[model samples]
Target: MSALAAARAARAAGRVALTVPQLLAARAAKQPEHVAVTQGSGTLDLAAWQRRTQAVAAGLRAAGIRPGDRVALVYGARDWIAYAAAYTGVLAAGAVAVPLSTRNAAAELDFMLRHSGAAAVLHGPDGVVPAVPIPLVWDPAVVAALPDAEPLPGPGPADPAQILYTSGTTGRPKGVTAVHANLTHGCRLDPPLRRLAHSRQFLHAFPIGTNAGQTMLLNALDAHAGMLATARFAAAHFARLIATHQVGSVFVVPAMAIELLHSGALAEHDTSCVRLFGSTAAALPPAIAAGLAAALPQATIVNYYTSTEAAPTQTSMVFHPDRPGALGKATGGGELRILAVDGTPCPPDTVGEVWLRAAGAARSYHDDPDATRQVFRDGWTRMGDVGRLDADGYLYLADRESDVIKSGADKVSTVAVEAALHEHPDIADAAVLGLPDPVLGSVPAAVLVAARPLTLAEMRAFLTSRLAAHEQPSRLAHVTALPRNAGGKVVKHQLRALFDRPDQEGTP
Candidate 1:
C-alpha cells in the first residue's frame, strides 16, 4: 500500500486518545525506560517523566485546577521537559492546556490570557508573572522540587484536551478547541518514531508556545524522543548543539533555514547526524530549497505547508532543484482543493484559496461561532492560504488569503498595527508592508504621508508606546503621496518591493 493508504488505514484503527498527556501515558507504558526529554546537561527517562507529570497533575489538583479549565503554559523553547510534564499534568487534571508565546509583551500576554479565558497559567523563566491573573503559576523551580505524580483516571475520547489559539490578526485571538481524537486523526506517526526512539532527539529553537512548537513536541513524543533545550535560538549555539547531541531532526521556519545556509556556520559544523530537517510556517523558495538540499545532502529537506487552523495539510519531501515552483503532493492527513472565490474548484495551476478537509481538521473556534462558521464548513478547513495545485498534485503557494504580515518567525497583523499607527495625530495616512530582510526574517516598512514633517524616529516612538515589540516597524519611509489604484486602496505590493532593493536606506 501507499503512504496515504497506510495513514488512512492506521487512522481507521479506531478511538485512539489524542490528548497530550494521554500520548505521554501511552508512551510511558510502551517504552518506560526510553529517553523522554533532554536539555544540555539533563535527561528524563519515560518513567521519570511519567512520575513528574503525575506530580504536576496532583499539584494542579491541589491548587484547585478542575477539568475544562484553561491553564496556560508559558515557557521558553528549551524547556521541553517542563512543557511535557506540565502539559500532561494539566490534561490529567481534566483541564485544557493553552500554551503562551514567550515573545509576547505584557500587554499582548494579558490580552491573550483574558481572551482565552485562562483560569491558570504556568510560566517558565522567561514569562512575566505579574501580567497574568491565573490562580496558580507553574514555575521551573516547582517542577524540579515536586515528586512524581500518579496516573489519573482517563476521560476517554470525548473530553476536551487542548485549546490552541489562532494567530491574532483581527480583534482578539480565538481558541481552537481540540479533542483527544484530533491528534491521531490529524497526523500519522510511524514506528521509526518509536523503534529508533532514542536515536531521535529534537533541538528546541522555535518559540515553544506556537502551534509549530507544539507540533515539534508532539512529533518528538510520538517518536519517544529526547530534546536539547535552549532559551533563545543563537545561530552559533544552535549549530553546535546539532553536532554535539547528534540530533537527528530539527524543526525550523523557512527563514531560519535560509539564514543557516548563509550563516557560514553550516560548513563549520558536522551536521551529517541530522536525518530530518523540517521547514514550515511559510513558503519555501525553490532556489533556497535547492541550496539547503545541496548543503545537507544527507538530510531529507521536508517542506510542510499548513497553519494554526489546518495543520500538516500538505507536505513536499522531495526537492527537485530544476523546478522553480514545486511543492510536493498532499499527505493523507487532508484533502487539498484549489477553489475559486465562489467556492468552485479551479483548474490545475489556477490560483485560488487552498481548501482542506480531513478527519483530523479542527471542529470549531471556541466562543466565536461566526468565525467558526466562516473558516469551518461542510467538513473542510479553509487554510486562508492562496495557492495552486499542479496536475501532479503538488501545491504552489502564491500569497495569503488574510493580510497577516509574516516576517521570518513573526506574524504581524497589518490591520492591527495600521489601526495603532492611524491613531497618531501627526500621521495623515499610513500603509504598512513587509520588507524582506536577510537577518531578522521579515521587518515591517511603513510608507507614510505625514500631515507635516514627521520623522521616522518620531513615528516609531509613537508606535512603540502602543504596539508590541515585534509588531513595531524596523524601518520607515516618508512619501509625498500615498500610492493608490483606481479602487482607492493603497498598493502595498508596490511598497513591498521597495524594501527588496539595496537602494533603500534604514533597513535592519
Candidate 2:
C-alpha cells in the first residue's frame, strides 16, 4: 500500500491512533519530499524515513527481538538521522525503545542496560556499547540491507512505547517509561494552533535521548517545518544554520543563549529569519533573556517549562517586557498547581511545591514502583520545584526544593541569589549553592565567572539593592568558567568541592 493508504488504514485502525509509526506514515502522506530532519551534512526526507523505519523494524524482529521487549538505543545528536530511524524502528517493531546517549559514560551505559534488562542494544552509527552481555548488540545501519518482513502488528494507544532516563543532575538517573498514548497526546496532524508556519526550517542542538531532543525528533516527524540540528553546539555554527537555512525558530537552554551573546555570534551572522526563540530544560535567567531580545530584535522570546517526568504538559510563556520574572503558564490541556505543605493550593504568588498533570496516561519509573509512587500520584507528577503562580497564572520559580539554602533563620532560594548575580555588570554566569557555616548550619555560596576578580565585600555591596542580607552569598569563589554538563546545568556537586580548597577561596 502507498504511504497515503497506509495512513488512512492507520487512521481507520483507531478513532485517534496516536502511535509513532502512524504519525510517520501520516506525515509522509502529507508531504513526502519535505526534509524531515537535518544534521551537520545529513538529511532525511519524510518518504525515505517511513520506508527505512519499516525495513528497520523487520530487521530487528528478524534478529530475534520480540513484542514488548526492551531495546536500548545509544545514539547522539550527531547521529540524528540514523537515530531517528532506529528509534522509530524499535517502536514499529512493537518493542519499547530505551534511548541512551553516547555522551553517557560506559559505566552509566551499563547501569541503564542492566536496569532496564534491555533484550538488545542497537548502537547504530557510533553509539556507545555497554560492557553488559546481551543476546544482540548490533548496528541498526544494517537494516538498509534487510528485506522487509510482514508489517508489524501495529501499536495501540496504551502499548508501552518509550523509556527515557532522567538527567542525573542530583543523583543516579531513573528510567521513565511511557505508553504510545502519553507520547502522542495533544499531537495532531492539523494542529489548530500553528507556530513559525512562515519558516521552512527550525534549529536546535539538544542531545539525542534527552527530553528536548526527543521532542525535536517528534517535531521532525510532525511539525510544519524541517528540524535542523548540528553535531556540536557552538555559537557560530548555530547562528550560521539560522542564516543558511533562513530558519524561522530556534530552541535552546539558557547556557547556549549566554554563550551566544558572550561570543557575539548573533551580531556577526545574518540570523534575521528567526521569529521565535524558545528556551527549555531550565528557565532563562532574566539578564540572558534581555540579551537575546536585543540581539534578535524581531524574534518573540518564549520560555518552556517542563521536566522528563512532566513533558507534553508544560507552560510556554511569550516574553513580555512587563513580566520578566514570569517563566510561563500551563498550556495545551496541561494543569499546573502550587500546593503548600498541607496539600492545599497556595494562593497566587505564594511559594509552594509545583505539581503538573499532562493530558494522557501517566508515566512511571520502569520496575521502580516506589520511585514511581513518590512522583506520580493519581495522574499529577511532582515537579520538585519551589515556585509560585501570579494572579494571571504565570509561574515564577524560586529554586529547586533540593537547592534551597537556610541561612540562620531564613530560607534563601539559590535561584534568586543566582538571578541577582547574573545582573551584576562584571559577572557573566553564576551558580548559588549552600556550604557549611558555623552559625547558620548552612549558608549561600557563590561560584562566579566574572570579567575581573571581585572581593566578597564588592559582591555584598553589589547585591545589597537586589538580594536580601541573608540571601547574599556568604562564601565566594572565582572560576574562569562554571562547570556544566552537556545539558547546560552547572555541576553543583563539583562546584561545591571548590569551597573545600583554600587556594581558590573567596577574595580577602
Candidate 3:
C-alpha cells in the first residue's frame, strides 16, 4: 500500500490503537519480574513500577486532581522513573500530564505553569521556588504526610493524556495537546516485536519532560523492557551505566555523540549489548554519524526525524548505508513532502521545508491559534525543517527553516558550514550562526571547539575550499566548547547573542 493509504487505514480502524496505561499494563503483566526502571541506585521491576504508578495516581486523586486538570512535571534524566510514573499516574487519575524540562529558564517555567494553568507541579532535584514565585509541590513534609493510594481509572481515547511543551526555539513555548488516542497512534506505528524484540534494555538519559523521553518511556512500557537511568549524561557515568545494565539501546542527540567522541568514553564501556543507537531532535551530521557507526559497528544507527507537532514521521536506519545523510523515507502512517517557499512540492534534490501529515500529529498549540495556524495547515504540520528528498525518496536535512542564515541577499544554511567545518580533524565540535551585520544584513559566524588551538586562518582556508564564498564564515570564534543544550543541538540563538554583545566585539 502507498504511505498515504496506510495512514488513512490507521486513522480509520485505529490499527495503532493502544493507550498509555494499557501499554504499561501489558508490559507489567507480560514481564512482572523484568526490571522496568533504574535510577542511580534504585530499580523497579514491572510489577513494582505498575504498583508505584497506581499508588501515585491514587495519591494524586486524593489530592483533588480531577480529570482534565494539568499537572506539570519538572525533571531531568535521573528523575525519569518517578516522573514517568507520575505521567501515567496523572493520566490514570483522569488528569492531563504536562511534562516540561527542569533545565528551562525560570521565565520559561513561569510562562508554562501560568499558561498551562497547571494545578500541581512535581519538582525534581531542586525544590527551590522560581525567581518569581509559583505554587508547586516542593514541600517534602506535606508530600510525606500523604498516603499511597490506588490508581484511578480514566476516560477513554478521547481524553487528554499528555501535553508536551514546545522547545520555544522560535518564540514563546506552547503546549502540544495529545490525547490517549494520540499516544495509541504513536505506539501502533512500530510494534514491540519489531523495534524491541532483540533489545531488552535502553539507557534513557534525556530530560524527562521532553517528547523524545516520553516516547522512549512509553515504548519501554509497551515492550516490557529495562530502562537504565543516569542523573544526567555524564560521559563517565554513562559508560559505567551501559556496562552495568548491559543496556541494549539509547536515544541521543548529535551533540552527545560529539562529547562521546571527544571524551573517548565509548572505549571505556562494554557497549557490546547496545544493539540500537537512535538520534533525533537535530541533524546528526555525516561526520558524527560516520564516527558513531565506527564506534559501535554492531549497533543499528537510526535517526528519527520528528517534532512536537508531528509525533514520529520518518526514520532511517544506519544499516541502510546507501543514503548516508537521509533521515529516512516517509513512514507508512504519514505523508512527508518537501515544499518550496510558495508551498509547492519541490522536485528531487531541490532543498525545501519538510511538511508532514501523521495520525498522532498534535491537535493544536493549547490556546494560541495564530501560532498554531503558522505551522498547521489544512491538515499537515510545516515542521520548519529545511531538507530535500532524493528521487529514491531519501530525505536529507539541511537545517531548521528558522536557522537559515539570511546573508545580505542570499539564504545560506548554517548546517552546510558546520558540516564543512566538521571535516576538519582538529575541530571537535562546531556551531554556525548568523550575527546581525549592518552591511550584510546577517553575517555567518562560527563557534567551534578544537582538539588543539585553531586559528581563523586555518578554519577559513579549510571551509573556503569546501563551501561557496557566500556560505563561508565571515567570523570564526574558537571557544572552549560549543554552546549546546542537553539534547545536543547547538543553541544558535544563544551563540548569536554571545557574539553580538558589545563587550565581546572584535575579539575574534
**Which candidate tops lDDT?**
2
User: What TM-score goes with each of the models?
Assistant: 0.75, 0.96, 0.89
What pairs collide in candidate 3? 67-94
Q: List CA RMSD, all candidates.
A: 11.4, 2.0, 5.0
Model 2 pairs whose backbones collide: none
Q: Show where candidate 1 strays beyond 4 Å.
A: 1-14, 130-132, 141-145, 169-172, 186-198, 361-363, 403-508
Error of 2 at 467 (Å): 0.5
lDDT (Cα, tens digit) per residue for candidate 3, span 1-508: 3222333355578555555666665556666788777777777787877676676677777777778888887765557666766677677777888887768878888888888888887666655365544444643344334456544554466677877887776677778887787776655433546356546677767776677777777666665356666667777777777777777787777777667766878888888777788888877777777887888887888877888777755555463556666788667577778998887899999998888887553566888889789888876888888998888777788888888889888888887788788888888888888878887798788887887766666766777778888887777666786666545566667776566555432324
Q: Cα deviation in Å at residue 355, candidate 1?
A: 1.0
Ranking of all predicted structures according to lDDT, beginning with the best and ending with the worst: 2, 3, 1
Clashes of each: 9, 0, 1
The number of clashing residue pairs in model 1 is 9
TM-score of 2: 0.96
